[model samples]
Target: MTTSWWTFGLQTVNFLILVWLLSHFFWRPVAAVIERRRQMARDLLDQAQADRDAAAQALEEARRRSAGFEEEREKILAEAWREASEARSAALVQAEAEIATLREQSRTAIAQEEEEAARVWTARAGELALTVAARLAARLDGAAVTETFLRWLTDKIAALPADVRSTLGAAGEVEIVSAAPLEPGLQRRVGAEIGAALGASLSFSYRIEPDLIAGLELRTPHLSVRNSWRADLTQILAEINHDERI
Candidate 1:
């Protein structure tokens, strides 16, 4: 193999020149493009992160507003319920008062009606008793009733005090009234018996009064005595009616 030192030198020089040209031209432009692409990607990533933070803040604000609105609604509903309850209680109280008033009025009216009824019944009973007594008295025998009253009168005069009897004895005259005319024999007997009982001579005069309803009456100027069915019945009816009222 023959040695070629010059050709080897020339090949080495050409390789060195090619390497410097590629480093100055192709390598520098490619490095610059790659650096520009990397810078753009970093800017996009930072912008995306900022947008995400803004969206998160907005969502939080909306949630807080919604919570506040819910609280306000609940407060309003509670106030409305309280007002309704108070109104219902007031209405109930008013209704109860009205009912009590009505009951009192009814009781008063009933009491008044009962009192009126009792009064009417009492009056009717008095009238009926008076009617019955008048009918019974109408059927009595006038002469017999008069005789009985005369006997009673004689006994009453006999039982008088000594002073009263003496005063009667001193009177000028006595009067006897009857429902019917008495027989002359009966009149003489009555005058004689009464004068004997009083131990004094007395003058007597008899008068007839048909309204006496079967009874007798004795009278002097200072004193009078009546024993008649009509008078007795009137007093009895008055006493009965007074008791009923009580």
Candidate 2:
């Protein structure tokens, strides 16, 4: 083959020019674009990593808040249960106190009723005793009983205090009350006996009082001497009533 040095030099020169042009324009611009794209991709990757860390922190905070809420709910439930128990205990104590009060009142009422019944029976008994005494005294009224009562009246007048006896004697007239009318003979005898006992002569007036039952009573304007079964029965009834009260 015949060698061509000029052609070879010319071809070599063209290839060097082409290489410089590509390095200055196409290669430089393409390499710069690729480098910029790579930098953008790295920036995106860094941003994604930061976002993941922030999201994880937020999730942890949410979990902590949830746990706090659960603890608060338990506390509220326990406090409510404690209050309810206290209320129940207080109600039970009140109910028992009321029941005890009612029972005491009932007992007091029953005791009062029993006492009232006993008092009523005692009063009735006292009345019956007085009635029986009065009837028996009435049956015993007679001439012998009259004579006996006249002796008793004379003795009663004799036994009086000196001042009382003097006052009775000083009175111009003395009244004699009896259960029945006296015979004229008996009246004279009775008046003589009374005058002898007083040591002074006095006027005598007679009166009938059936309520005396079986004895005599002497009466003046300001004085009364009761020596009779009726008076005795009245004293007994009063004593019975007083005893019942005690």
lDDT of 1 by residue, 1-246 (tens): 134777787789988998888978988789988988888787777777778888888888888888878888888788888888888888888878887888888888887777567667665665565566556666877567666888877787888888887888889698888777889998897788778767899999999976666677777888766676656766775676577557
RMSD of each: 13.4, 8.6
Clashes of each: 0, 0
Q: After superposition, how far is residue 233 of candidate 2 from its true place, in Å?
A: 1.3
Cα displacement (angstroms), candidate 2, residue 167, comes to 1.0
Q: Which candidate gets the maximum lDDT versus the true structure?
A: 2
- lDDT to native, each model: 0.77, 0.81
What TM-score, over all chains together, does every model reach?
Answer: 0.44, 0.50
Give the range where candidate 1 is weakest over 10 consecutive residues by summed lDDT: 125-134
In candidate 2, list every pair of residues with a backbone clash.
none
